[model samples]
Target: MKGLFKSKPRTPVDMVRQTRDLLIYADRSPDSRESKREEKMAELCKNIRELKSILYGNSESEPVSEACAQLTQEFFRENTLRLLITCLPKLNLEARKDATQVVANLQRQQVHSRLIASDYLEANLDLMDILIAGYENTDMALHYGAMLRECIRHQTVARHVLESEHMKKFYDYIQLPNFDIAADAAATFKELLTRHKSTVAEFLSKNYDWFFAEYNSKLLESTNYITRRQAIKV
Candidate 1:
């Protein structure tokens, strides 16, 4: 038959083209095809993970370095915003924790390179909505506090947090009647202000009157604690 001699089934490139067309069709279909969309998103996430592995892997050869950089740029170009939103709801607590660690590692490794992923994640409105959806949970708050510290390191991130509705939850967590949470929040706040003195001082100058009374009261209380300890020692 003629089919039996058909150039070894049109070669590998033909197969790849067919597969790509199928994916394109599925991705553009209606919401009724949600399962297909989810599968596509999962595949995207897998590719991102592989790219991250290459970027942060143990190999230090120039080829590996170049490949890593290329992969990161490609991944960022393709899925920077989508990855942040998709990963938020699907990530388990461990994955969430790892995500924070990855952001920290990226900051340390790149220094002046600009945080493409974190900047995209922080700015994506969909991701912000998801982030704030769990704002009231204690565990989420803890993770958020850590992320906020990292965000405060960058001016753009600091501005995003300051303008977000999420700021209310953070302020509430710090002012809670629970002494333990409040204490933890105070420690975190002190660290944030120490690290980001100029930006935070500017923020305080504009907004201090809104919170100055409570902050001053807390400062006085802390002073009183130190004074009482000294008196007891005397």
Candidate 2:
């Protein structure tokens, strides 16, 4: 009788939908009263923490596979990932950490033995553009850079970025005065070149002269000690 009266447990899909709704709400400009805005942000953070717990099990228990599948399926179904990424900057530091973890974990999550995150990313490739551009935003670079690194884990995603115009910017990004962002950018640049040897070889073969010209002039010949040290990795 007590069990019958209890509220039905929220399904993983329900949780994702709830999170999406909050994200949509937060995505708008702040016209609401300050307290209400704070309340909404608090709710959003709680929801993200719950999402993290679902993807990565909490201390109390390991994650259940079925729930994870449902959550992951619902996650990439629409523009949810895009919403999360664009709205990430508005979130508090703790919320940003939770969302970043959720994103990084999702990139590895398999749905029906398939990496659906990769497929979603393939269709919404522009999200990679936004993330790559994060290297230029001081406040967002690390968060966006972290997510971007996880995203390029897919060879298709890696190839898209390797071939995109963003490749040209990594020269300056790897030399930013902020060592952490520079290092992160360097890691991502190295991964883009080294991850899929075949794709990288083909890209380099075609753009070899131009790419190395910039590499030598921009990185190898840079004034910064850190930049010169990173240039040696190439």
Candidate 3:
């Protein structure tokens, strides 16, 4: 019975210790198995709430340590890329949210930039799907949308979403009743289009009426101006 209770386990401390030990081990190992290191980090990622609690409980002055660069490289390897994609759906919302921050930290590591870029781009697709699904719940939509937009901006992932049929439908759906929601969606869409001219052209060519009806007339005129400018350049 005492063993069963076991003081409920100090999981947060254990997790921090394990993560630090993994980093140290990976650093000292000559010809370390990077895949194993990444596996350990991925396991650590599963306890995101515990990790966050621990991190926040500590002095606010102490910054979160970056994950090892080799582990990030291992994660970007094609085989591990598939594993990450598969694991993303299993992560809870808090874990998924923390992942963005982790990726940002990894990106700042000089040796890990390329690997972080590749892994982050792949991971972003799954995150975007999660964001879109959350949009179905009105209470969560705007919050999730803002997070999604930030992710898209950081990763340049909005191109994929802007080109997706599902996202187009979502944009249209948001435009139906709430002017504020519609305006927000339009602003996001406009930013996406600005980044991906060809995608916007294709979308506008196919769905001109919907855009014109839902967006303000001034925005429509501006879009037309851009389209005409591009046509002339062509």
Candidate 4:
């Protein structure tokens, strides 16, 4: 019947849930060449684009809807972050960028009364380390780097990143042989040091002995122009 074929409108929650399911399947069987799988991925991409539009808004002077933001925040509170992280390294370039953009946009929203907060980010502190590890994969580094920068926007996340022993790994990441990955690592380094001024200052003062000594030799005086530039900016 025509009635049976009519399209049902999807709410924001429905779209997010669908995205999460697709990400899980994509991550588990990324190399599958089946037509159904490919079609599902294309549909997933379309859903993400639509979700981006809803959270942002159209071209008119119409005020952005607070309802969309609230719905998105609720979605973040679910297991969606796990799906996003697991799927980031599996997606193609375009979908990966869109996925990272979704996380970045969510970081800019607030759920509990305030207009800007980090409830979603603060809950997932371990993601920073996982993202840092993403630098090991050349194909996924840029997308993960973009997501890392957004995570570091939260003071709590920034502090965790600075204090974790993982901070020592940047010395090698910024010097990676691949230009793009190294450049992205350098940008992530700069964001970590500069985003929360007071936190970084405290971290530096506390770890003054070895931190600067390594920084001076590897980053500041390095032959790579981008490394030196990023050091100066940091």
Candidate 5:
């Protein structure tokens, strides 16, 4: 009889839905109520960790591909990604890291052999702008910047970013006062310019004059030693 009251096991779809619900709550929750928000944030973090473990598996078991597919499909199908990005600042450090990894891994998940995350991102390019702008926010820079780099692994998204006005911002982003942020920005900068050779070539060719001018001046001759080194390497 006691076994009849046991909680039902959650499927991957159930996990995705629950995680999305928590993320929405976080996004809408007011910081005025710090204690309650903290409690919800902790729950959100646990859900995110559970999602990660389902996709990546734990030490005791390997990730189930079907579960990963379901999670990925639901994640991109709904507003989960957007909510996570917007609510990131409200989360604790560990939660932010888990969320970041979740974002990064989903970029590679395939649904029915199609890269659906790319499709979702292509339809939601404005999110990229928010991510790029994050470089200016010291606290959110690294996390958003990492997710931004992963998003560009999709050629369409990379092309959008390359053509956007944000391309010019990386020159300063890579030299930000925070070493970790600066370095992460630099890595993202390199990934953008090198990832899809054809798209990058086309962009560079069209914007060669202004782009190279900024590259040679701001990055090559920047006051920061790491900036100069990275510029030369890239």
Candidate 6:
């Protein structure tokens, strides 16, 4: 009877909506670095962390709450993924890291639970493309690059990214002027090539002649010591 008098927990939908609003506000606010904005950003990070905990806290022995899974499904249903991607480039470093962590967490969640559908990817193919284009924005490169790696963990996503024409852009990305951007791109490049060995093997066998030639000339021979080191390591 006492439980009836207790306050109910906020729904995952409400929590996600609040976090999304905060992020959008932070992005558009001119004085984003102001104390109030910073406070909101901190709250946003806390919300994501809490969502992660809720979605992933259960042990294999314990069944996860339907509410948690519903929240995750709602996150995609609301097209909140687009919100995260749009705000990523504008977020401060710590905020961006937290956001990326949330994305990675959500990606892993689908693997453990069937509540979130794989068809979500098919519906949001543009989100994957946006992540790929993220490299074009130096400020966003690392954050989105991290998200991309997590996204490709799924076999379906890995195959799509592997086969996309965008795969060719890695050669240019690996040689970008900024060390951090170039390095992050190279890391994603390596993951794409090595994560699914069978898939990569087939890709290489099919594209062998020009792929290695371009890789050798563009990355291996680059004047940047980091690029050279990375290419040789690959």
**Candidate of highest lDDT:** 2
Error of 1 at 200 (Å): 1.6
Error of 2 at 103 (Å): 0.6
Better of 2 and 6 by lDDT: 2
Candidate 4 Cα errors over 4 Å, as ranges: 1-5, 29-33, 58-63, 115-117
Evaluate model 6: give its lDDT.
Answer: 0.78
> How far out, in Å, is residue 29 in model 2?
4.2
Per-residue lDDT tens digits for candidate 5, residues 85-176, read: 99899888898999999999999999999999999999999999999999999889989999999999999999999999999999988888
TM-scores of the candidates are 0.54, 0.96, 0.44, 0.87, 0.96, 0.78
Q: To one decimal, what is the Cα RMSD in angstroms of model 1 from the true structure?
A: 8.9
Model 4 C-alpha lDDT per residue in residues 1-234, reported as the tens digit of each score? 889998989777788888888877877775777898888788777877766677666586442566676557656757787677877665667777777877777777765555343666677777787888989988888888888888888899999999998888988898898988988888888888888899999999999999999999999999988778767876
Candidate 3: segments with Cα more than 4 A from true spot: 1-46, 49-58, 68-111, 115-120, 123-127, 154-156, 176-187, 194-210, 213-234
Task: Estimate, for each residue in 135-229, the C-alpha lDDT of model 2 and write its tens digit.
Answer: 99998899999999899889899989988999999998998989999998998898898888999999999899999999999999988888989
**Deviation in Å, model 5, residue 51 alpha carbon:** 0.3
Candidate 6 on 1-234: residue-level lDDT in tens?
998899877787788888778767866786656788778877877777766666656454343666566667777777677787887766667767877877887775553446253557666766788898989987888889999998877667777887888888989988888988888988998898889888898888888988989998988888888889978877
TM-score leaderboard ranking: 5, 2, 4, 6, 1, 3
Report the C-alpha displacement of residue 150, candidate 5, in angstroms: 0.8
What TM-score does candidate 4 get on C-alpha atoms?
A: 0.87
Lowest summed lDDT window (length 10), candidate 1: 10-19
lDDT of 5 at 38: 73
lDDT of each: 0.48, 0.92, 0.50, 0.79, 0.91, 0.78
Stretches off by above 4 angstroms in model 1 are 1-52, 58-64, 78-82, 107-134, 163-168, 175-188, 216-234
Worst 10 residues of 2 by lDDT: 28-37
